[model samples]
Target: MSDLKKQATSMHKAAAGLRAVGHRTAKPLQEFKAQSHDLSALGALGSLLSATSEIREGMTTLTKLTRQLEEEWEAEAKLIGEVSDAFDLLDVLIAAKAQAEKG
Candidate 1:
């Protein structure tokens, strides 16, 4: 396999792993949000809840970006395969040209 193809495969795997982690975190974040409402009555707890909400939003955005990256990496892997195929075809043509010259 070409270097580009290998790199694409690595990137795709990493993105997929990160996406899975994001999904795992999402459930906990939802639960936290649900439980946090009870603590809203406390004085300083309001600030804590606000910060947690912001963090949750940021996590949600990051998860979405991770999913998008995973899709992009998958597409990149396919493109790399196409490039490898093109290189193989070029190699065959070059070999044929050399053979014809020898004849």
Candidate 2:
């Protein structure tokens, strides 16, 4: 419920979406690359293949980064949950101290 937790969760979801996109597009891109071989007669075939290779590499990098982001976000969320628990404990302690003083 805390702001930090929300941010962390959002980050995790975003990373997952990025990862999904990377995965989903990969097969199609590879298929396109394979199909491209049939177009060898075209003067621009070399350039097209080169561009496709670049895109595939970029997607690979993006997927890697997304995985890393997911890990970081998960860790951050756990830390935020711990901090939130600590704050709750602190509140309880403060209340108990007040009660003791009054008693």
Candidate 3:
């Protein structure tokens, strides 16, 4: 009966020690949970920034394409003028050849 009584006393002391350890450990575990929440918020912010940057890059690309189209439009306008001048020169040549053959 005395041995059983000693065992109960020893178990009670062990439980008290474990409780102290758990109390101390709980604060850091709570701090880790808060830090995880902070990290998750940062991740969401990073995704938004990434999306904004991609939109900015897309705008820049569109501006470059518009400039290239403008340049091509100017080049096409000049070619049209050259073609019109060539047609006029051809008409003059045909008139001169017909006069030469008639004389």
Candidate 4:
């Protein structure tokens, strides 16, 4: 395989890892929100509830941004893979021409 293909493979793996991490993060964040919602039932914890709400909102935004980034990364990986394939084809053609010249 060409070096470009190797690089594209690495990039695709990294993007997949990022996506997995983001999914893992979402579960905990959702759990926190659920726990916070339960805590809000107690009037004495108004300040804490307010802070949790803010944190939840921020995390939600962050999750959205992370998802967008992951999508971009995946797209980039696909483009890189395509370029790598082109390079591989070019290499094969070059080799065939060189062999023909030798003949």
The top-ranked prediction according to TM-score is 4
**Top model number, lDDT:** 4
Candidate 2 residue-wise lDDT, 4-94, digit = tens: 4555556555545544554566676566555544544444765666765555566666656655765666566556555656655666676
Kindly report which residue pairs in candidate 2 clash with one another.
none
Q: Write the per-residue lDDT of candidate 3 for residues 1-103, one digit (tens) a residue.
A: 2343444445445545544554565566556544533444445665766654554455556555655655565565455445545555665676778889999
lDDT of 4 by residue, 3-103 (tens): 64566567556656654665676686667546644545545575655665665566667656766776776676567556656666776787789899999
Query: Which digits, one per residue and each the tens of the lDDT, describe model 1 over residues 1-103?
Result: 5454455556556545644664666686566555555444445764766675665566567656756765675666566565656656666676788899999
TM-score of each: 0.53, 0.55, 0.46, 0.60
True-structure RMSD for candidate 3: 41.9
How accurate locally is residue 42 in candidate 2, as Cα lDDT from 0 to 100? 42
Candidate 4 overall Cα lDDT vs. reference? 0.63
Instruction: For candidate 2, report its TM-score.
Output: 0.55
lDDT against the true structure, per candidate, is 0.61, 0.60, 0.54, 0.63
Listed per candidate, the RMSD to the true structure in angstroms reads 6.4, 7.1, 41.9, 4.2
Candidates by TM-score, descending order: 4, 2, 1, 3
